[model samples]
Target: MNYLCLAGPTASGKTAASLAIAQALAERGRPVEIVSVDSALVYRGMDIGTAKPGAAERAAVPHHLIDIIEPSEAYSAARFVGDAERLIAEIGARGALPLLVGGTMLYFKALFEGLDAMPAADRAVRAALEAQCERDGLHALYRELQRVDPVTAKRLQPGDQQRIQRALEVYRVSGQPISSFHTEKPARELPPLISLEPADRAWLHQRIEARFHQMLEDGLVDEVRRLEARGDLDADMPSMRCVGYRQTWEALVEDDLSELPERGIAATRQLAKRQITWLRGMPQRQVIACDAPDALARAVECALRLVA
Candidate 1:
């Protein structure tokens, strides 16, 4: 296994299990470096809300692709694939294992399944589309996408602004249906995937709630305030749209910290649910019940066995 992946829903113990796996590999004289698959972790100064690996943990084990961008910037699946490929090669050249870890399933999908040679994003075209959306509503643009590229439209919701706009932009820019470009993508080798999930839903929910409250106790609100004070980021940015950050930003916008706990916890649970759904769609993943007493040990064994 040239590449090993450890993925799970939020608060499902993925971080602890990944650290243990890396340590176990190191003890066996096989160094492993983690490459974050998370979109949120790529941004700097968004730590507490992201449950990012602490300074000590990162110092203990080399981590890649974290804090690589500013909150005002955008990180896409294509960019992630490019960065991960480079890091995986470099890490392997150093004779260490590259462990892909995080809850960003779309990155994993793009890396393992291969991204189609779609047209690069055209900012000018996209801006025009955004203006049109503002004037005519998202439904009007979605309807236009349906007319231009129904195959892509069928897979998207009427309100999926990013994808809807992209599909339209592709057609308008390249005179081709975006879906037509996906007809013949070269397949990629599927990496060994280990997924940590809980057997008890309520147990996972409790963990999510507890962790959100702990993030608050750890000054996540202060973190958000600092980011907001920077004046360059907003709620619509990908960084602020993160589960915890989004809820905290809304609370701050409303000047109401009291409702943050409920809103943040609820949003985190919803994120976990979406992650689990994505994990289930990947048939190659090996599942481990994360709430088990021996989960970490089992995860280490599984990882070591795969990387051996």
Candidate 2:
């Protein structure tokens, strides 16, 4: 069975390109289904900020693994891999090509390259770390991490409490540095991959800024407000930790609405930078310029060639 993985940074036109490829293939009497590879898109009520395909779009082309979980719950790369593997099999059984599309490079990596062997999350250790963070602040834990695993500490930001806690938890559970577990491991077999990005960095940045403002205009704050009013979600949840949602949640809580757009855009750009860095390390992917006028046509051609 042939598979197509379309990956790129957020707002790089991966969805439209994938939809076009699916449509073109359908015209050729070949059915294609999209299995979203995005982490943020999995949460319910995270529509606008996640850039989830609208109802009309989803109706036009089938999508899987989206809106499969509530915001109050946690979803992990392991869960994503399990869901994607099952979906791939189902799509294959139906004789349709499976197209994995999104900006979540970690999910793509876990799906294709497999994950590191790591211990499960120890709730007791995590709670202890959380308590330590609340009492002594995140910097103290970061300092402790520096003493134990300087490599991971240097790589993570001092304010990254979630990761800092996890790294510490890993150490507490396994008596080994988390970084050591990141060494190369056996991987699952995958099909052809096409990575898309704008050739002009400036253009992509502009698009990021513009799209953020557009999201604001499209009621992103209101969406966050609705999520907050639900009383079941909180800022610390993984779903709420998404780039724009996090900034917007803080802005709403701190009553600093004016800085919301700027902060959200900045955070999104940082996310894109990290995503691009990951994409750069992926081997054997056909990279395409998403900003090209004929990008969709080029993508369809690439998909056809891959499956042929």
Candidate 3:
């Protein structure tokens, strides 16, 4: 199926732009569906932090693959690839265009460039990795990854604990360097691809700060409070480790922060910076410099040209 992927750094207006594009397509009487590519958005009760669309917006356009998992569960790129393919096929069967959207670079990359053939996730291995992480430190495991899969290690930052653990876990389960299995192929054989990006970092930084503040006002703290109240405080869980959520959890439990919103905003800004760094690595993407209002039109024009 032909898919249009709208991806960029956090606060780059991907969500709003994708919605607008879907609206435009609907106006043109074309079939369309928005499939989330966000890792954080998959979790239930993560709306405020993940910036999920509200009920009204979702009612206006069909959205898929959202709120299907709990914060305590693990979600991976491979699983996303499988689920996304299935969803896209189902959407296609219904005569709709699947518009992929979010700032999850790895998800987009995994969809386009196929992942390495690694063993299935072994819970025991993951448990062992977690234990190793606490006993030896994430840095030690990262260094071990460098020895085992230097290519992946080189691409990953030292503080990227999740990825470090994942690579190590793959090696442990399969007894092969995850790097050795890193073959670059399309996750799904499909039509031509179009990737949209932000053209300016300065403007995006402003948007990032503004968005975080808006999220707080929109009940991000309350969302975290609810999640915490549900007894899902396991920091090792991916959702708890989400950028804004994790930092908020930290401030709420460990640090006695009177200004919780401020703390959450700070952490979000840092995450946006890392997201910008990730986007910069994709130099080949068709980037447009503009805010949310302008992004959808730019993306639509680009998509029309690519698919023309």
Candidate 4:
């Protein structure tokens, strides 16, 4: 199968670049479809925060793996691998090249190297630990994690609530460290994948800030309002905990846009830094350094070379 994956840090102009490549392939009479590699974009009514493609852009080329689930359901990288592989195969069956695009590194990892079984959520233990978190504070629970799953705890930021809760839940159910379950063997597969990185960090940061401001101008607040109105802000909803969505929710509750947008921008910048680190680690894929205007051309050149 001829599959092309476009991955980079959040706010790295990856969306536009990937779309451009897909359009270029289409222009060359190659049947192509975009399958989102994003975790957040899978949830419905999460358009602005996830930066999901608008109706016009999607109509221009078929997009898949988006808006496939409600916010209340949690999805894992293993599930994403299953769904994405199925979609890619169906697209390939129809003689179309599948262009995989997004920033979820775990999804890419799972797709490439497969995941071992992890403990499922133990609601009883989760409820007890979550209650403990509410009463004793998240730090107390995180400290508890540090005692048992020290390695995983070290990897997580102290303030990371989701992962902390998950680790605690794992200990409760499996009677073992969550870190033990994370197993990957050194295996290799040749995928028709092309990745792009911007040469200048300063330039990419500016683009990140500009794109976030544009999202606000495009009614991100209203989008959040609509999702909130639909009860998507409820704690059980997975989309509520997305990075951007969480910040916006804080803004909504505080009614403070004065500093929230800048906070959002800063968070996005940090995320982009992590993405750059991820890209640097993936040594096998074809890499192209990009500027805005020439990014598409460079990526297309790489893709054609790979598929040749």
TM, every model: 0.87, 0.90, 0.84, 0.88
Task: Give the per-residue lDDT of model 1 (tens digit) for 1-308.
Answer: 67799999999998889899999999999999999999999999989999999999999899999999999999989999999999999999999999999999889989988787888777678778878988999999988888989899999978667679889989999999999998665756788999999999999999999999999999999999999999998776778889999999989999999999999998898889879989999988999999999999889989888887
For candidate 4, the per-residue lDDT at 218 reads 83
User: Which candidate's TM-score is highest?
Assistant: 2
Q: What are the clashing pairs of model 4? A: none
lDDT of 3 by residue, 183-208 (tens): 65634554443444455556766776
Candidate lDDT scores, in order, read 0.91, 0.89, 0.77, 0.81
Candidate 3 ranges beyond 4 A from true positions:
120-139, 147-151, 172-176, 184-196, 258-263, 277-284
TM-score computed on alpha carbons, candidate 4: 0.88
**Which ranking of candidates, highest lDDT first?**
1, 2, 4, 3
- CA lDDT for candidate 3: 0.77
Which of candidates 1 and 4 reaches a greater lDDT? 1
Best by lDDT: 1
lDDT of 2 by residue, 112-194 (tens): 78888888888678878878998999999999999989999999989777789999999999999899899776665667888
> Per model, how many backbone clashes are there?
0, 0, 1, 0
